[model samples]
Target: MEKTNTVITIGRQFGSAGREIGYKVAKDLGIKLYDKEMLDRAAKESGICQELFETHDEKPTNSFLYSLVMDTYSLGYSSGSYTDMPINHKVFLAQFDAIKKIADEGPCILVGRCADYALEEYDNVLSVFIHADLNARIRRIARIYDLTDAKAKDMINKTDKKRSSYYNYYTNKRWGDAVSYDVSLNSSLLGIDGTAEAIKRLVEIKENNNNKKL
Candidate 1:
């Protein structure tokens, strides 16, 4: 991996306002913000359909199909009577490549898709996990997406479940575990802009040290 000034990867729970925090932090720091834009770029670079990538983005595969999934991934095809592997998984792999490619391009903020774990070993990377209380998350989702409270709650549960599974499967670390991240913030306590400011301060410290060493 090429040297970057700093790379921040945010792992966020649904409706936790983590994306908003990431966007604001990146803006304040004058760095590129990549969320869905990363997906679009991945699709273009890898020649994969964007819709297909979206279908598999941050979704966990059924545990029963673990062998098949790994086999298809490794052998490039299914070995059993099952139908050929879905194109979406292939597109996800492409997006994973694109994620790495994007990180290699320059410093940026990556939201979701286990980006923290993806660049785990890189020295200049900071992994952050943003979370909030259940009621707070539900209210935020309900207001933003115009969902009923119950529906918002359900959506939050399902989305977080998939994210946890996907992150755990790929990284072998507990999802949202505080120890897994450089910093974990409670968005409900500090609010979106406040969270962003805290992240900005951390980034400033990191950049200052990096500049001094150079």
Candidate 2:
């Protein structure tokens, strides 16, 4: 299939195999996938330390403070004031800019870090959310991490909470909501490869429809 200038942003629940699916999609499409690598790029581009990005990764902060920092960013930051801004705000903006820069580079698969919200205004963006049944997620996490079921379940809840909080805090929409994405899939139903193939089909359909309109 002829590739379109499309950017795929995937939002996923913890232990849903979303990252694996994203990798497969990118490989199948012969494109790059951005996950943790995005943080490296963001840190390099923003001149922030990479450790900070890791520390604040998918973590939420006070909404009011976020607004304040964003407003300061808009107005232009003085050296002293910028230094005083919350670290979470700085990391979020850095990642936000990195996401835009990545999209501008060309077709790619971006996993999480609110990539969909970051590229909301772009024309050729497809946002997808991946979720699975709780039991399935628990089993996947347990198997992958070599943890007991109880520990795996605990990690899943904690990780999902952070992701959801981060997404909701940064974007106006709710995380994991059907209306927030172009499509939401259950990874357990189709397995990792099948889910990736399904997303590829959606991308093809979207590209064809867009081409017809053009």
lDDT of 2 by residue, 36-111 (tens): 9999999999999999999999987767767776776767777778677778888888899999999999999999
Q: Where is model 1 poorest over a 10-residue stretch in terms of lDDT?
A: 75-84
Q: Which digits, one per residue and each the tens of the lDDT, describe model 1 over residues 124-202?
A: 8888999999999999999999999999999999999999988886665889999989999999999888898888778
lDDT of 2 at 212: 98
| Runs of candidate 2 exceeding 4 Å displacement | 62-83
- Identify the candidate with maximal lDDT: 2
Q: Please give the RMSD to the true structure for each candidate, in Å.
A: 4.2, 2.3
What are the lDDT scores of the predictions, listed in order? 0.82, 0.92
